[model samples]
Target: MLIALISLFLAGSSGGSAAGSLTAAGVLALVVVFSAAATLAVSFLLSKTLLRGESSAFTLELPPYRVPRIGQVIVRSVLDRTLHVLGRAAAVAAPWGLAVYALANISAGGETLLSWFCSWLDPAARLIGLDGVILAAFVLGLPANELVIPIMLMAYTAGGCLTEISSYAALSEVLSGNGWTAMTAVSVVLFTLMHSPCSTTLLTIKKETGSIGWTAAAAVIPTAAGIGLLAVLNCIFG
Candidate 1:
């Protein structure tokens, strides 16, 4: 949900379907297809090579086919997964959110901490068709995947805290005001897809693997892939 929403928002912000403007659906489609294919390829490669194991023979038992139970599915989705993930996410998001809010709001030398940090990151971020603000949002929003877009909006609008624009037009205006282009939209969508797991997922990975090194690798791998791909694409087309 977070990824889809952020992709859509960036697409629209790049002047999607506006008067005499091209929509970013083309770029979004490309990113989605490529990201999905890359993920599949990596998984296959890992299973076949680094993580290979001898095949085991086993007998399987089958249950009699029955009609699907809608209520049971709903209960399982809510109780078994949704709430559990949400609880963990909330635990990380709360304090992190407060820190983000404070950083964005507190002025330092006539600029907020976030603004200063973004300025410093601008040169590198531009290589990938994104600005420092977007990169900073991803970093600060690490506590929860869902916070990326909101934090971006807050940064772009210079708001004291995260704020949602009432309409797409307003969002487009703010983004355009910050020099957003179709290429920027494409890069953002790709990066969002490739970026590291949110804090909750990182915690889960650590718990499951019991290795900080592996957890760190899991985070770095996708981000590096995203950065390299974005740089190539931006050079070719931006």
Candidate 2:
């Protein structure tokens, strides 16, 4: 699970335009170090607490090595893995896409639903060094992390649909125009590393655990840690 979260963070950070800058690379390295340390610390704590159990060791029987079948392997890879993941992502993203469109289009008393929702979340978001739009983006992006920046851009521009920036320069301009700063970027990176898993991941966890309690824990633990850490950072630096 920690590996999955770190992978997501790496993907997000590396995809940004700022990633090309030396300063951004340094920040990424720092975050990577922090992630590694946190993973080890969390694992140790879990072993001593929630995961305490009698030690047991078991050996697995090795499967006999077999020659690879290229055609069969390709077929299984496409049909089983690629299609399965895409299907699940589409199932979640389709509805979310519609909802986002509506939220951006519909308005009451001169405020779009998206704006109103962001306003409502603004106070809490500010505590974590993020704006309401960014928070709303993260919440709406629960379906897929890839939607986050697009959703944020749409909200910022009051666009009726997701807005895609074609270049990193444009993306950086939009973010800065919306008041993003170095601290904001740091906060965002931290939250990206620590926030809850995407919807598909949560569903998979629920299915694998067969327990709502564990599934909720999987979502909540990292989020709570993120909130706590950000709160402290804001207090110290705000």
Candidate 3:
């Protein structure tokens, strides 16, 4: 699941003009390799420690292939998968949208609520090679990963609403103006790959595990790992 989510991010990041750049492709490929290596290392360590047990072999009977039924396939795909995912996303994103609007618009002590919150996070975020606005965006983006960049843009522009970048050049300009650098970009990419899963994924985890403790772990472990890695990177590069 984590791999799939990371792959989606990589694909989206590479789209448009950036997709044609060899450097961009190489960077994304390296990210994929690192993710795979980290996954394997963690799985091996878990198997030898916390998940230790006698190995067991299991097999499943394969179903015979059948000719495709286009109508039935489309119906099942739309109803069972597409609608289910959209419904879950909407359930989580709706309240988040309102909360984001209020945070960006409401004022306290002559500062917007969102600005105040970002200020509060600034010290810790800087320690990880990220600024307050970037960290705030990630937190606000918990409902959906797709919202992260737009939220950052909104906050950066003081737009008090989600803002879209019309081009990669515009995105680069905004980020540069906000003090982004090579190290900052590296840290952001690492964090994006390792942060807690989205709201829907957390809910699904809770449902499947039937344990709040495990659900919390699912959120915390990856975040902790990301923070630890970012700290190391900052120490080395910042």
What is the TM-score of each predicted model, taking all chains together? 0.76, 0.84, 0.84
Q: Could you tell me the lDDT of residue 228 within candidate 2? A: 87
Ten contiguous residues minimizing lDDT sum, candidate 1: 14-23
Backbone clashes in model 1, listed as residue pairs: none
| Cα lDDT listed for each candidate | 0.79, 0.80, 0.82
- State the displacement of the C-alpha of residue 152, model 2, in Å, after optimal TM-score superposition: 0.9
lDDT of 1 by residue, 1-238 (tens): 3234344454454444452143345544666788789998776766787568945357899999999899998999999899988888888888888889788989999999989988998999999889999999889989866677788888887889787776666766787788877577667777888989999889889988899998998899899888999999989997
RMSD value for candidate 1: 4.6
Model 2 — which ten-residue stretch has the worst lDDT? 1-10
TM-score of 2: 0.84
Report residue 12 deviation for candidate 3 (angstroms): 21
Using lDDT, give the best candidate's number: 3
Backbone clashes in each candidate structure, one number apiece? 0, 0, 0
Model 1 misplacement above 4 A: 1-30, 44-83
Clashes of 3: 0
Better of 1 and 3 by lDDT: 3
Colliding residue pairs in candidate 3: none
